[model samples]
Target: MRFSKSLIILALGVSLAACSDSDNNDVEVKPPVVVTPTSYEFTVTITNLTAAQPFSPVALIAHTEGMLWQIGNSASEALERMAEGGDNSQLLTVDFATHAQSAESPLPPGEQLTLTLTTEQLESLKISLATMLVNTNDAFTGLNAIDVSSLAVNESLSRHSHAYDAGTETNSEAHGTIPGPADSGEGFNESRDDINSVAMHPGVVSQDDGLRSSVLTSQHKFDNPVAQIIITRTQ
Candidate 1:
């Protein structure tokens, strides 16, 4: 999440280069050196939108193409680790990633965290982000393979993301199965004991929602659009 001042200035130069105007009277003008940044500075702002579910530190990556998690596909081990526990180390180190960044701490309910990522060129311009809903079992939010090429300098794009189930683990909601501050239990078991495909997370059914043995309560329940993510071309 650190960028040098020189890199920041160079990014600003690229933005300025993108805005040149040519007059009709000009006989011939050379195109600006499209300093297609071998690297670019991207700013990501994540806001936890849940009322009570705090989010784990966000993981952001830039890749060529391909989603981090596909709806009908099984969750990757890296994703499973993050969804199950709050650890983003494996996800940040996924092989296909061209560049990556991670937040230093969790984003509490209604809190926000901003991070900067730099990647070389549009070849790695696809953006992916993920973070766990700390109150649930294997639930996470954010987008995958979002095209950022068209984003103009200083412009931004924002989205509200829903929770997704890694499906590698069951939604038992038992006393010690759930991770996060609510349970402080174990994370990332090697078992594929649940429905092994990614899907929109069915909101947790806490003790208040009829799951008697559940350690969670009504305060931990959540619905769609759990987090707000904003990306700016802040070279």
Candidate 2:
């Protein structure tokens, strides 16, 4: 059949448009665009450097910018609980912290714990860690609100930590005062009989050192550095 000139032109136009659309579809579509949110990750390694003192479960927090605990200031109820009973439940409730974690068990002398924490909060990164010496009245050790925004991937900050007396309780080392395996004594007495401030821990005076009725022993004594902390950014 003979077609009109207008009909022929219209058919040609339609064929060309279909061919153009097919060509466009055949052109490689850049693979579906994918958008991923930025994430920050850190690896924390803690090593117990004491002789016989067992460290409570490490309480770790990755926060925006705030001190969890301060030297010369009274400790929070959370810290006092962990420092006394080796409990970490309360300390993990760091509302200002973007992320926080604790090891399952106590860290013994000469042992280490490595934990990785991640957060989407990429700015003003800081880390705080704490643990109790289960052998003392209220002795604890670890870093507090350390600035880590300057750390590069795979870069690390290492420090040897000194013991800190939480000062929430007196260092009696008596029959019912210590809470470690060495004593199995009671923990977390509400009455505050201590200096009520944080300070450098004085080494323990065991029964061997003339603290009569003391539950600790010579081996439980530790020097300045009680633990080591190494922090690194992985991703």
Highest-scoring model, lDDT: 2
Model 2 agreement with the true structure over 117-220: per-residue lDDT tens digits: 99887678889989999999899998988888888999999999999988889898998888999999988877778988888898899999999889899999
Per-candidate TM-scores read 0.83, 0.84
Could you give candidate 1's per-residue lDDT for residues 154-209 as a string of tens digits? 99999989899999888999888878888988777889889999999999999998
Q: CA RMSD for every model?
A: 10.9, 12.6
| CA lDDT scores, all candidates in order | 0.87, 0.88
Q: What is the lDDT of candidate 1?
A: 0.87
- Residue 69 C-alpha lDDT in model 1: 95
Which of the numbered candidates is closest to the native, going by highest TM-score? 2
Residue 85, model 2: lDDT of 81
What would the TM-score be for candidate 2 when compared with the true structure?
Answer: 0.84
Candidate 2 residue runs with Cα over 4 Å from true position: 1-35
